[model samples]
Target: MKQKWRNFMTVLVLKINKNRLHDEEFVRPVTDLLEDFKVVDYREVKNLDFDKVIICGTALKDNEYLDNLDKFSWLKNCKKPVLGICAGMHIIGKILGYDLIENKKIGVEDNKYYLHSFKIEGLDESLEVENFKGMLFHPEVLNKELIKDFVNLT
Candidate 1:
């Protein structure tokens, strides 16, 4: 018997700053979760063509992190699924009419310490995982107003 090949592919958008890729502790977990998935740098691709593209880390302007959001505007119009993690979430929020601002905290905390929770809004049963908990370590966060536009999936 032969194993079947899965066509699903995933691209990870990593920010390059000072000619180096941003390092985040969650990277390993995220990559492990998507075993066998293809990972591509967002800067190398001329177009947003993929089954799914995950945006991660901060891409500040002129910092070699690809801060030019206009270059990837096609994302808003594409049907392809997107998963923004941490800073990636902030980028998505900023693109979708929400402001991303700085918070006061820094450093990582265990999931038990933070107890972060999110509420699902404007979504039907089709989008499951309504309410759940997850670990987050960012000084900035998505504006409350934009919460309605996104479904919280842990």
Candidate 2:
């Protein structure tokens, strides 16, 4: 019984914090998003060894990791599948030269990190796309101008 991600495993899970960033909180519920991969602290990005990457949204701020500044280059230069969620999305936004702005928290019943819905754009209509609409629970907002080149999977 071979695992789904065993064939050329390239998934890299970034351990992140729930508040004020930093890593060390890469939990199962979050890593479950990917079939297989290795979990590494956000600080050890220089040792990253994978063709694909997944960034989870955790409670984080800039000050926690602003000084470390080692993985940013690798993240920006890697030409592989990169999936950034919540805080991860903010990292991507910054890598892509966008400014993160505060938005009215569009949250669920009691979750400050879950938005009610998201309108996806910048997708190729030819591909079989699914789940392009749903709740987005994050406090950051990257202007449309910066995301024009990004693919929105909802």
Candidate 3:
């Protein structure tokens, strides 16, 4: 019997925190979900040629991780499939000229319990499969005036 060769999808995991890269609970689920795909840390290599890239939650404050933004900006030019979760979304917004504003009210300290409704505009109806109700832990928000080209997949 011959073993079948499965096309592997490479996903770039952007390093956010110095400690999180070591967290098994955080890393395990993602690798499990993409069973056939390989998860590679973006920080390990200089040049990347991947099928898709996912930007996980990382410290993306201005001047905090300013250097990382350049890499993401370059990724945008690649026009490959990219998924930015929380901080990832903010990075995309910033790259598109949008500024993130801190929302003082309705803020939650715990990372487990902040849920809000997001309206997806200018996206294909097929993409809007369900209303995304998930734990949102970001203090920054996207400025609509700046992100005009990218479709909002909320």
Candidate 4:
């Protein structure tokens, strides 16, 4: 009998947090689901060889990453697909011209995956920003299937 091999995709996890402890809360869960991945600070997005990029979220109140927007400048020219979660979505939104005001809601809202919206609530557990590219919610906690889909798609 022949064994079937699965295609594994390399993922780059960008950690956006002030405290390393947040890595356990945010980064670890995402990395746990990936077969091939590398975790890097949001301020150090350098490598361009990964198949996909996952900008992991920080704590709800952890907004230190907001102070250094220049670190994510590479995202503008990055050809590889990317996914942003929670605070990750905030980084992307700021990069895309969305103001980072107290009003976290910057884009349109939809059912289920909020799509472009920055926040999620009620039945909506995540946001699908233009394809499965970005999400405003944490799949590691809410929807594990979505993360699996992202791994497969990338």
Q: Estimate each model's TM-score.
A: 0.52, 0.56, 0.52, 0.76
lDDT of 4 by residue, 42-99 (tens): 7776667888888988766677778898899888777777788877777776666666
Candidate 1 lDDT tens digits, 1-154: 3222232454444442233444343243344344345455555656455455555443333223335666456656656556554445444554565444444333344321111122112321112121211113321232221221222221
Model 2 residue 25 distance off true place after TM-score fit, in angstroms: 7.3
What would the per-residue lDDT of candidate 2 be over residues 98-149, giving only the tens digit for each residue? Answer: 5555543344434234532221233211111121111233322322211111
* Clashing residue pairs for model 3: none
- Over 71-142, each residue of candidate 3 has an lDDT whose tens digit, in order, gives 555754656556554545555556655555553223354332222223123321112112211113332222
How much lDDT does each candidate structure score? 0.39, 0.45, 0.41, 0.68
Against the true structure, candidate 4 reaches a TM-score of 0.76
What range of 10 consecutive residues in model 4 has the weakest lDDT sum? Answer: 114-123
Where's the lowest-lDDT run of ten residues in candidate 3?
125-134
Instruction: Please say which candidate is ahead in lDDT: 2 or 4.
Output: 4
